[model samples]
Target: MAHDHAHNAPPSETAMRVKALETLLTEKGLLDPAAIDALVETYETKIGPRNGAKVVARAWTDPDYKARLLEDGSAAIAELGFSGVQGEDMIVVENTDEVHNMVVCTLCSCYPWPTLGLPPIWFKSAPYRARSVIDPRGVLAEFGVELSDDVEIRVWDSNAELRYLVLPQRPAGTDELSEDELAALVTRDSMIGTALAEAPAG
Candidate 1:
């Protein structure tokens, strides 16, 4: 009975790399190299972005739900049954006709991981983290989301335990759609106030 080796390469690379590192650790007589590898794998692969999408989508479809979410985000999200680990005390900021909001973890990368998943490559960079608060309008403009000066901008600074998500304005032409269909209009960044969901075409 021949075993399937082709199905083994990508995962094998990590095992191979770990073994190489483990050999060095063993030579120095370290006890837990394998444990370290396990931790890395558990966090990197098992945890991701789907949770963030769920919350965003839910907010898009339910106005009453959205009101609850904005009033007490952590509790409202917990009501959806998606809270813990990377997301606990979550705050939702609503973007509206009068004001536009955006979130930034200026001190460090504090995010609602249980909701949004891993941060995008650009977000983890220094330039974006720095410029988002100091020049939010400029940062948004780069992403093609322009705003009028009268639309007051409020930037939330995320910290270690608290997380923020944006409640994007519902897309136009979606009033006639079903709840599930409207949910599809929400995007992670849009919910976080960086962008607006694209309107459904007529």
Candidate 2:
């Protein structure tokens, strides 16, 4: 709660502990907050879900690319020159009318960073990791996705070696849109199976 936050209250015990640790690390020249900020900014703005969006849009416009992505996600993603430590190996799953796919890292916050940038806070939270596997439809419902009971849900757990990406179904009425236009319709939540891509207004 705002009233209980460290910003509003006296320095919280947890905050004091973290500040003390930061001071110690800074004295030892072991931590640089500016460097951390720069790295985080790189992921949050310059390199983000837009990279994955481009991949999804290309797949939607080109059948061959879609096949390649589904067949070999790592290779197909590397085709776009977006390869890194957390994304050396990736498994792409498709979402259809009858089946939905989701990804989670039960042990830790392993994620496809090259495509997704940084995992959102919720993705790394215990509640999400646990509830996603046990009550996937219920989790999706919390994200405003109410799937039909007839649709089956599949969950994939990602680790350091192989991460998972969900290829959300391309919305209808997008036949006239250009590849870039389609990319604009793809969002971070859609790639994570929490939501669907936006449909063309026309």
Candidate 3:
């Protein structure tokens, strides 16, 4: 958290190219800024991490649902109405006291677009793809997650056929929280296994 990887970094080539294309399209009157903003808003709120957060929250609050989710991820997730394209073959991995789960796509950035909208730039980078498996703890440290040596870290490799979603451990003192309240603590990075769910406010 303290180290903001993208804070001072220059825009990636893909990002720059997208920006240039957007500019050109706007100049040619083919792209409306307002419509672009609206589309981005829909993805960010309606179709992105919010859907994954809701799934996590439901599992936290319902043991039966959690069991079904772990047993058949695709079916369980589809029950929540989040199944499409890249997300058709989902495998939900849960994090417990003894184990932690992280996901990476070594070959390419094959991600669950239905639930997570789009993969982060870091997830698609060559360094992350290669290093996450070789040095998972080190990669996690860079993300500000320091786990005890006793805890086992499992890195799930996603591909074109199967995508993974990390079910982060529920925070303490959240037994009284409602499903929506719990969902609020489930950040995108948490579901991606780069960060933990935020602890509830005092």
Candidate 4:
């Protein structure tokens, strides 16, 4: 069954309120727009999903590192120097042929900021928070991920104390790819379990 999902849903009320407050503050000369842009850039580029991508790439190439990561997500991730704030307590979930893992914050939008950066608007929406748990498979389908009936779907609920990151399965034709090359295939949504790692280009 195909679902008509709006991937670009409008910002939630909270986001609108925050934007309004920022505008008001900017108008009052209290908040520097350049500073805000710099901060967003830092998270969006430098310290964002790239950090998680590196971690995933390391795990993909090194079995020992992958074992440690699966055993102690926080410590293993800290080795890569991505830790602080919402990412203090992390749990790495592996997605295999038999099982697919999806993460959601049922109570609030608790995310691994150091790894995933800012949460997407849909992640904080009432519909996603509620529906992700109630209908995980449907949510995956909405995200354009289709799994076979033989595959098991596991939905993880993230909270203030613990956050989950999905270590997506590596693409089949990436055997000769370097760690950096492999990292390039990892995307933010894949780590968040909303999508799969990008396949290598021809």
Candidate 5:
């Protein structure tokens, strides 16, 4: 699969793309550091975790919506107005006692960044990409998540056309908790299905 074009292409071509974007942004007065920081802060606080919490809360309280989320994550998530940008084509995978799901980007890190914010540096690492598929149990062990031998592991390799998210099982003792409180219990890893949300101790 080696391509002569990649080997022969000038490195300056990649650099030029960045240079051109920087030039355009600068000329349009859109590269202000303060404005960029404000935008990042607004999204990081307002949209990303809010979406996760909403999904988790619904799954905890509504059986019908939970079924819909498990069957069609994009449509279920769209119910909360969480779509577009990186979330345009989202898929939600649910983990059960018999089957466990894990996601990785074998080709590139195609992720639901709108709902999950940015992909962590570790997610974009070559080690994670290779190990998650080849040694999923080992990777999960590193994350302190041990699976039973009876459970079958399925690794999803994300493509540009589709993205995957995990819908972790809700914790117990949260039956009376409000949606906002339930949201607080949903963690980033839980949404990825690697970890389960824990109910707060009274």
Candidate 6:
């Protein structure tokens, strides 16, 4: 039996170049290597969409918490111990059958990183920023989310001062799910409004 070595190949040229650039910046004291590492660790562990997922799950399970979340996203999210620069001012929009809400940063990727983790490259791409506002339905269609003709689609453009997060509708048959299990069904794209929450696995 032969093993595949494709996965063991050296880093791509672009990756190597990026690594070299980072090394140069670190050596020149232009960048704080420790800070970069800490940021990466934060995203990978402490700060991520899981925070938002937990919030969403709680809201789905507790009506009062849901009301509080919808009334004041920043404060409600703070109640969950998630607060930071990018998330100082936040708004959470709910997705309903009659109204589907989407969020985008037209100027730049002004995302709620504390709760939503890092924004994906597509979220920051010029195409997404421009199209998400111009033709939100088309953009959602591109992502394979087809809404009924009667369902109103509202596109929220985030800015430096404030950010928006989507509270996707809870999937059915998950009434018995534990908080952690419910969180596991959430995805980064779902929180970003690019996709729906994962349906419960049978």
List per-prediction Cα lDDT, in the order shown.
0.77, 0.89, 0.92, 0.92, 0.79, 0.89
Check candidate 6 and list the clashing pairs.
none
lDDT of 5 at 88: 80
- How well does each candidate superpose onto the true structure, as a TM-score? 0.76, 0.83, 0.79, 0.81, 0.79, 0.84
Worst 10 residues of 4 by lDDT: 1-10
Instruction: Give stretches of model 1 more than 4 Å off.
Output: 1-50
lDDT (Cα, tens digit) per residue for candidate 5, span 1-202: 3588888777697899977897799789888767867887967786675576688788878889988887888888889878877788888887777888887887788778766777777778898888998999998888888998899988888866788887776777887888889888988777765666766878
Cα lDDT for residue 128, model 6?
Answer: 98
Error of 5 at 129 (Å): 0.9
Question: Per-residue lDDT tens digits of candidate 1, residues 99-195?
Answer: 8988878777777776776677677779889999899999999988999998999988786677888877787777687766666666777867788
User: Residue pairs in steric clash, candidate 5?
Assistant: none
Clashes of each: 7, 0, 0, 0, 0, 0
Q: What is candidate 3's lDDT per residue for 100-167, written digit by digit as tens?
A: 99999999888888878898899999999999999999999999999999999999888659889999
Off by over 4 Å in 6: 1-32
Q: How accurate is candidate 1 locally (lDDT)?
A: 0.77
Off by over 4 Å in 4: 1-41
> Between candidates 3 and 5, which one is better according to lDDT?
3
Off by over 4 Å in 2: 1-38
